[model samples]
Target: MDPLYDRLARELRECIVTGVYGAGERLPGVRTLSRTRGVSVATVLAAYRRLEDDVLIEARPRSGYYVRNRPTKAIPAPARSAPAAQPSPVTGQELVLSLVKASNDPAVVQFGAAVPDPSFLPVRTVERALARAARQHRNRAAAYAFPPGLPELRRQIARRMSAYGCATGADDVVITNGCQEALVLALRAVTRPGDVVAIESPTFYGLLQALDSLQLEALEIPTDPVDGLSLEALQLALERWPVRACIATPNFSNPLGYCMSESRKRRLLTLLGARGVPLIEDDIYGDLGFGPRRPPPCLALSEGTGAEVLYCASFSKTLSPGLRVGWLVPGHHQARVEYLKYVLNMASPTVPQLALADVLHSGGYERHLRTVRSDYARAVGRMIEAVTRHFPAGTRITQPAGGFVVWVELAPQVDSLRLAQLARAEGVSIAPGPIFSATQKYRNFMRLSCACPWHSDVETALARLGTLTANLSIG
Candidate 1:
């Protein structure tokens, strides 16, 4: 390499190593960088040219230069002569762990977590129920938790499922650590590595995480923001792929909050059942619909299918997320799910499950959800209106029937990751759109949580977000 070329390559490589250029990130144009750094355009071009030749950067026509794909830094090897520990069992699950951790950083505003407002939850009522359970099981609190969760709690879950038109008995229900674990158990019970599972596009990240851990391939079906998955697209996927299972959120799906129409629900179940595709319905947010009446769950809608829908739900969303109480109504796969649930973790927390049962039996949980639904509805309206008024023209937002999330579309020039960083500096947390995309296509979109108190400060925060959005360069 020429001397200048060598120097430029070294500098650019160092910048990339230090995250100045960053992974999957496009760098400023040569002319712009030259102007900022007071270097000759030729020198800047030479640097980029050398970097490209070295496979350290790539040029996209009309899109400027981007850092090339580089392997992540390997862990430093143990001291050269040290005894090598046996390599940890490799499961090919690193991607899932990385994505899940990225979502948990406290610095971010947490539009990513499908959590309801704590203020809206009946915390006091739950506390009281806990108190009652403590008194009732004072001596028992020292004992090991009941396997598969408390029997009465399972019975309570069964009663609620009855409202959805599924007359499932408590014996068929297996309580797990949370909805996530319930999903993992169902997946483990029905699927093995290399099995293709169908999922809605932009589906719940947790579900994706579970699938990734299982070493399963997810075939995404195009989903409508307002109507859940497209039946036609799903039919095509089913016909084209040998899918072992289908995992979906038919009511108030996370991120998008799309509810499948009852007619579509019936049709989808019929179609999947006909094709022998086992459906895993995540109804965690079912009871939190903003409207007065709740849509019957997909499991309820799949009543006559003789056991096709493996329904899973939890109070983690509507109640205390920390409680980590959830269940799986396995329908046709009941025995398998129950056995897997036992093998995986054995059971959920005994005290919390018992307390939740008491809370449900006493009707406080219903009242709490009613309050959450009303407040969340108002917050959703306020957010949608704010996005419309504050965002630039052509911005589109979802009007979900329930839940406190709104998906906003921005002009293509606005990269949400950059915007989220800017928003965080202003004491606001937001979920960037890329986190929800498997293919990372929604750089200009974001998901906002309306689960916070709609107070003056939050209102100002919303306006500030709008201002940031409006001032974004569309270059």
Candidate 2:
């Protein structure tokens, strides 16, 4: 269905939920709604059909659609994190190792991977773009493309970055394999072995892995479920320890999805600048925001502040992840990052760059973003609703403003690793909380990915997880 119809469906869903149209009330006729909303009759019908699929409304044989009589449950977000202020080396790796293995298993209902399904991607468009790019650039398709990547792709990226308040040209953007490689390059540019880097308590495991690979110590900072990394904790940590750098995901961080306010972003920049510690920002989830406008990356606010923030992002989330395309905007470390890029893999693939540039230049990616973002919002809502209904009371889940992943904090009596083991026995997979912490904190928490296409099996998997959690709590 067109994104236009999805927007219409979302608006109607809100109206019904907010009691603008009471339960069992008949909705306007498709033709009438189409006329009123300035959309085609087909669009309105599609919208209604979608709502019916979601069981939000029902279609009568001789009557128009009516709202379903399902009661809404209020689920609360998790409390703020208060991890130990001291920096610690990543200790155990068993939980992440198990999650990594589960993520690739075909039989397990996949919630372990923090990635959207193929249904969320623009498969045909991307294929067409790739084919066209290879045909058009037949001469350069096989070449290395070298450091800083293809100029045209960088140019298109630079253009998109302008909307989010980042001021940069093609010269500043260095393409990498994905956001992971971008992050590795950023960490390398700023910190050395044994350097203490501050991070969110329940952070992305990938970041922890990178820090471990570089032999960097991680100072897990206190993070709010609503706000992002705590500046006060970071300030105190800076004062207490010899912190070398800070890494964060201010916009829709993994596991715990929360976008830092603009004021906080500026304050964070100033705070880091004062301490002479650079910030390696993971903006991978920046484009997936369920808002009117994309939140500005800290790099956007760092333009004139002289605060060095290594901005990293990728098309993996918004576009095709298989392409392995990502870029970085290293403020002062551009030269070193590009050199590291040269040393690591020589350069990113040439064809994907050309293809992405083609897709961006065509201007269809934004439309694609609208569809995926709405689909994720809908999917996340359903997943949260299922958790509330199936899981025990006192369960606190993160209410993400963007991104498909959410953090669930279960009762202290429940151990996420044990829950994960039990859920896997039932052919379900999840990222247990212990994997997200350097000091093995959040043992009772787990992060779930709502990127899968909703279906009965997926619903069953969540139910099984809830059952396992209940069993674990009892044990």
Candidate 3:
């Protein structure tokens, strides 16, 4: 028994998903849809708005709505992860460095880094914004910005945060160099050296590196590829060890694209509050959700519950990463995080902050996001199809709901590091799974980037990767 609006929305969503309306094809006007479907104009409009919120449709001023390009075939998502449950010392720095160096080489087809292709970014729009910012505020651009960052940028971030269900004002937001610095400040705010922190198994390599640099112990928790962190496992770890803090990307996690359920988020917040531990949430990829609404973060659910969730995010994933503009909502630990940020580097670059602020204020950022979301979804779909066609029979992959990376698990006989080396020699780059874990598990796993548009070169590289995997398996 869905409501009238819900029913209408669902029906129309199915039509869009099933290609009843193809990409860039216009849908029936409000009046026409109302008459044809025997529903009120208001109902049709509501349904359209729901679709727009999901990034499934776009409304033109007088031209009606159009179908957004999205993945048609549903790739089966990866299964729940099972990593060693004990706390272990972080390693693999050399491997990470080597992989990063290789992934950055222009000679290779990059399926290793989790970065979006430059073509996917709004370069012209951003350049125009930057020029305007420099001309309008020459003095401001030249001066050094202090820790809390530009007021206009913070205000814009606060406005965007409300859309994601986190209620906060400009005064509560602290800008940093990027999400990386925000995460570092958050880690410093909550944990001491040698303290144990619980993290998702097969988590982002960058997080593992951060833990290693800060001399912290990692307790890997089993995580599902679709549902995100295993709350049951987290509770068990909390009971067994003296976990000082926890970090996770609850909405569209990196490597393994998954968003945690809202119910589970509430329960996790409650559990952390009861244990008097803080949770550092990385929401950099939250805006890329391919669904109707952005998944709410843990901080939104923990409001007024006395549970601390240090929220970190950036425009790098959705906008220009080169600008290095990001922010942190430090919950109750705002003062400490602000201080750490001040001591860490004084402040982020002023020119880029001003440029980004102008972009956000002019409403250009949102428009750009809509375009890229569609592009990324289409690219991911193509990657999934290519993988299915070329990989071995037992290959399993993650069909991410959002974000631009896919995790693939091959037969146990294939070693990812060796495969990575072979792929590198063939001018194809990939992120081996062993680097993602402190224990160097997932020897047969690798993460591939789906940020680039489909092209013959990418297709050829994927086929070669599959061949390399098969050859290694035989060896």
Q: Rate the local accuracy (lDDT) of all candidates.
A: 0.73, 0.88, 0.86
Model 1 clash count equals: 1
What range of 10 consecutive residues in model 2 has the weakest lDDT sum? Answer: 92-101
Is 1 or 3 the stronger prediction by TM-score?
3
Report the lDDT tens digits of candidate 3 across residue range 1-475: 3357767876786787788988999989999999999989999999888677555688988789998755455446567889988999998757877777765687889999887888788888889988988999999988988978999999999998888788889989999988988898999999999999999988999899889989999999999998888989999999999999999999889889888899888888988888988999999998898886878988788876668889999999888888999999997788888889889899899988888888999898887776677667867766887888788777899988899999999888999999999998889889999988988888999999898755678889999998998998889
lDDT of 1 by residue, 1-475 (tens): 1256446656677698679978779988888988887778888888887566445578999999998765353212111111111111122223334333544564444443456657767787888888888889887655646455678888888898887688789887888888999899888878899888887766666776687678887776677777777778778777777889988888988777877889999988998989988899898889878666889988777768543888888888788887898888776677777667667666566788879999889887776775567556656766765565556666777778787787777777888878877887776777776665444546787788877655556667777888888778454
Model 1's C-alpha root-mean-square deviation from the true structure amounts to 20.4
RMSD values, in order shown: 20.4, 2.6, 8.1
Give TM per candidate. 0.76, 0.93, 0.86
Candidate maximizing lDDT: 2
Q: Could you tell me how far off, in angstroms, the CA of residue 305 lies in candidate 2 after the best superposition?
A: 3.5
| Model 2: residues with Cα > 4 Å off, grouped in runs | 1-24, 29-46, 58-65, 68-73
- Local accuracy of candidate 2 as per-residue lDDT tens digits, 1-475: 4579888998998898679999889999988998999999999999998887665788998888998775366788888898987889997765677776776677888888786788889998899999998898898997998989999999999999987788889899999999999999999998889999999988999999999999999999999989889889889999999988899999999989999999999999999988788988999999999887889999899855657888899999889888999999887788999899999989999999999999999887987997778778877877787898889888989889999998999999999888888888888888888888998898999999998877789888888888888888888
Model 2 scores a TM of: 0.93
Whole-structure CA lDDT of model 3: 0.86
